[model samples]
Target: MIQLIECPRDAMQGLPEFIDTAIKAAYINQLIEVGFHTIDFGSFVSPKAIPQMRDTAEVLEMLDLHKAKSKLLAIVANVRGAEDALRFEEIDYLGFPLSVSETFQQRNTNASIAQALETVETIQNLCQTKGKEQVVYLSMGFGNPYGDPFSPDLVAEFVQKLDELEVKTISLSDTIGVATPELITEIFQVQITSFPHITFGAHLHSRVEDINEKVLAGLKGGCRRFDGALKGFGGCPMAKDELIGNMATEVMIETFKEEGYSLDLNQMELEEAIKLSNSIFL
Candidate 1:
């Protein structure tokens, strides 16, 4: 079965206005009932960096997790954020973005590539000690517009480094929605074939017109995990001003169903969550 990760935090982070903590928790609580494998629910970053998510801990307090089947994953930019997130025993995974592009690395995390790698090693150690897992996102896993050097070989080398650190899960991110379907296939094929032990995920950003092709390409390249947001709502604010939306979760579900892939989702709950999204995003 494919693992669908609902990313409401990613959907909301770049918004200019702040969402109410109660409302954010209500939406995520409903999503938890939809039975996704995981929910990318919130982050532990600085309020200055992402003021929209300043209430993540407050939101977590409101979630009704006693009956929740889905795991919670929070994004952390550095070891400090990771430490903050670790204090919450309810959080199951910590996500760290490690960009292959030097320019993006600094822009997104305020750290160079070397510094980010060291942070990952430190966070991985914390997770191990705290009994939590880490999910590393290869931001700019596709090409970038900053004139940064990029290639399939470069991505493979990063994978090797992370693998040496015993990082088990990595998501290839199309940070600015610049990935072609061909490139998606080629990159995922290389990483999956080369590192059989690691679980590869696709966190693709795209225009509505290109969503189907990109989703299909990831599947064809042997990726079973994917991250999506309702209605394709958000993108990386640090990447650019004109953000490319996330892969729409509903569109992905449609494509997977048409391809004869079975997903373990609660249709009734999904419909309710979609209704709530209409209210929250506007």
Candidate 2:
């Protein structure tokens, strides 16, 4: 069975207009009822950086978790953000982006690669203390346009360090959609084989035409966890001039179904969420 993680926070984070807190909570609440394994619903970062998600805490309070079966995950860029997210018992995971591309690492987190590692160590310790799980996203995991050196070895080394820190889950993020099917297969296969204890996920960004190929490659390489957004609403604004939206959840669901992967999703609830998604993103 493949685990699907729906990422509404990634979809809304880059929007120029502010989404009402109530609306955000309502949409997320519907997603919870749809029965995804987890929901990446919001972030606990500086308001100045992502003004759209400033109301994450408030939105979280409004979610009707009484009957929702999905676990909640929140994105955090620093230790401060992690601390804020930790205060909420509703959040089951804290996601932090740790880019291997030196240029993107500084641009995304305002910290160099070394500094980001230190932050990860601190955040990891904090998660352990609080009895919460931490998910590290290796941004630019496939490749980057900044001309920074990237290879399977570099990625392996970074994953080794993360494994040493007892990081249980790491998502290889295609920040700029530069990954090819071959690259995706190779990287995921190596990571899965090398770290048997660590759970690896694919957080891919891709053109609509390339979605199935990318997803297939990841699956073939031993990845059972995937992250995507409804209708593929958002991408990393800092990566390029034009945004390459996230992996569309609808596409992933359809593909998995055709491939005989049982996802345990409610089609009625998913359709309702998709309809609601248009009102939010369109």
Candidate 3:
């Protein structure tokens, strides 16, 4: 059975317009009914930077988790963002995204790789103190567009830094959709062997054809807890050429279904989710 994670909120990042907060909160309840064990809902960042996520706080307040079978994820770019997220009761998971490529890190978050990890350390400590789960999103874990050479050793070293922070979950992000199946195997081999207890997963940006290859490698590497967006909505605009950022949940379901795996998603419930997503950004 595949434990497919859905990411509706993250999927809308690249959307050009900001939907009404009330409408957003209204749709979130629909997604909660589906069987996705987790949903990366929204991020706490500057409105000017990622306008699509500007309503995060209000959306969290409006979210109805009366049937909270699925965990909630809130992306935080830095210590202050994580600090702001801690003030909310509706959020269940705190995600920290750090790009392995230095140039991309500076472009995306205005922080170098080292500075980002320092922020992660601070955020991780705060999450532990505030009783929140910390997740590391290793952006460009597969490859980067900034001419940085990708390698398993570099990724392993980054994961080692994440381990030191004691984060419970980690995601290898294919930031620019450059990861091939062979590299996926190499990178996964190192991290999974080193951190057996950590719940690691993939946060991909590649097309449908590429997903299976990477997912297969992830499975072979003993990874669990992958993430995907609904209807392929979101991607980081800062990426070169505005690349699509997340793996779509609908596509994810189709792939997992072929293998007879399930995250227990109700087909009718998912259609409702799609409607909710369309109503917001389409």
Reference-based TM-score of each model: 0.99, 0.99, 0.94
In candidate 2, stretches whose alpha carbon ends up further than 4 angstroms from where it belongs are none
lDDT, candidate 2, 52-92, per-residue tens: 99999999999999988899999999999999999999899
lDDT pick, better of 2 and 3: 2
Q: Candidate 2: deviation at residue 101, Å? A: 0.7
Pairs with steric clashes in candidate 3: 11-234, 235-245
Whichever of 1 and 3 has more TM-score, that candidate is 1
Q: lDDT by residue for model 1 over 54-134, one digit each (tens)? A: 999999999999988899999999999999999999999999999999999999999999999999999999999999999
Best candidate (score: lDDT): 1
Give each model's whole-structure lDDT. Answer: 0.96, 0.93, 0.80
Give the poorly placed runs of model 1, Cα more than 4 Å off. Answer: none
TM-score of 3: 0.94
